[model samples]
Target: MTTHKKIRKAVFPVAGLGTRFLPATKAIPKELLPIVDRPLIQYAVEEAREAGIEQMIFVTGRGKTAIVEHFDMAYELEATMSARGKDMSALDATRATPGDIITVRQQVPLGLGHAIWCARAIVGDEPFAILLPDEMMIGTPGCMAQMVEAYNAVGGNLISVLEVPREEVSSYGVIDPGATLENFGGALTEVRGLVEKPPVAEAPSNKIISGRYILQPEVMRTLENQEKGAGGEIQLTDAMARMIGTQPFHAVTFAGDRYDCGSKVGFVEATLALALAREDMGAEVRAMAERLLRA
Candidate 1:
């Protein structure tokens, strides 16, 4: 039996050029784009923190300096806000301890596998999390926290899965399930296999892998020698696929709504949904949304 250790580190692969968002992303990293007020990456970081993750390892690329600055303390800005009697509590989540955050440059846009491989040094031997900031999962308890709870009971490697329509299975890494375990009032399926973007007819199951993952350290070693799979780029799914039988692998069906904020439509949807959920602006936002629909 494998002994499960506490997860203390998380990797955020923000190296993507964000070509989907084009000009806006050409200057600002997509992870830094605001969903409502907080940037996309902050949500991922907050989720990790809520899961008791102490260290955040960001695999960044060129022109992504803003992300580093965003998490750093802004002495002048904070001083100005304090002098003006502005509430500084809201910025607390963005601040990190001196050594809590680590940034490594991917140098090249190889793939998610390579990006994660880049952080292997920092992650060392612990089981770490990988959170794609673009995938915004909203729920009472954050997705990573939920996964951590499940991880505590059965720990090897776990990825969050969601039941998408059968027709939509081709767009994600479809899982071949083995056995199902009850967790957090949801189901955790033992992942027998993973197929990246399989055609609908060939899909093993409609349970698609979401962006949250609690991967063991051995995955990094697999990724190191991983060849390009699916998309001519090193695929994380491919690397993870290699680690299946070696350890306990499971997929937790996330009980929440996930927004693919990497796309324009998803970004707008997340912004509107988050705005409508806010106590200070819910009524006004809902009223405007209703009026806009009628118009």
Candidate 2:
């Protein structure tokens, strides 16, 4: 049996401008926007915790201080709630477990790789998972938890993969699988190569990359002197591609519903799906949705 290697740290890149949401995101980080009641970023952090990730490192930018503060203890609010006999559970919900969360400011408007590079000192030397708040996957065991399990078994860099429409290939990173690993517990296949947002005609397969990733530390070394690529951004894909032949890289076909919460339509869909799952609101929400469909 492969020895279990626990992933102790996770990197979240939350510094994006969120230009898709436009006016609403003008003052708020899109990650802070709620799906139903809970903020979108909270789901990503919770997923990390569920996967045994002890430290959550966030790469943030200016005006993103609220993202850090939201995960920190709100002592005054907790105190007031206690004085008013309010449910402590509600107050406790705001706090991340002690020593579990930390924030690093990405002062420059670099790309995802650069944002992750800012947290290098804190991440130290170990394989780390990277979760993007914009891509929220709803699942029974949670997306990152599943990826962690696969990573533990295979002991290499793993990325969440799923099939997308052929025309949509350019919207995401595509995977090229050389062979299928036998007896792998879940829907996972050893990845032969990766192509970044390739045109539909050139895409090797329909499998597009998802947001969850378990990457080896060596990739950071690649990113150390990585030059800008594709759209003039320091693409993380470029760095990972450099690690291809050196390290074992694979893709896990995650079983779940992924919401592109970065987009307006996806945000609405997530809100509706989560809201309709709540016992108190489920019936009414279902009825309203049915009525709207009928009309």
118-180 per-residue lDDT for model 1 (tens digits) = 999999998999999999999868999989988998999999999998999988889999987
TM-scores, one per candidate: 0.97, 0.95
Candidate 2 residue runs with Cα over 4 Å from true position: none
Which candidate gets the maximum TM-score versus the true structure? Answer: 1
Write the residue-wise lDDT of candidate 2 on 204-274 in tens digits: 99898888889878778788899998878888888888888788888988898999897899899999999
Give per-model CA RMSD: 1.4, 1.6
Query: Least lDDT summed over 10 consecutive residues: which range in candidate 2?
Result: 89-98
lDDT of 1: 0.92
TM-score of model 2 relative to the true fold? 0.95
Q: Point to the candidate with the largest lDDT.
A: 1
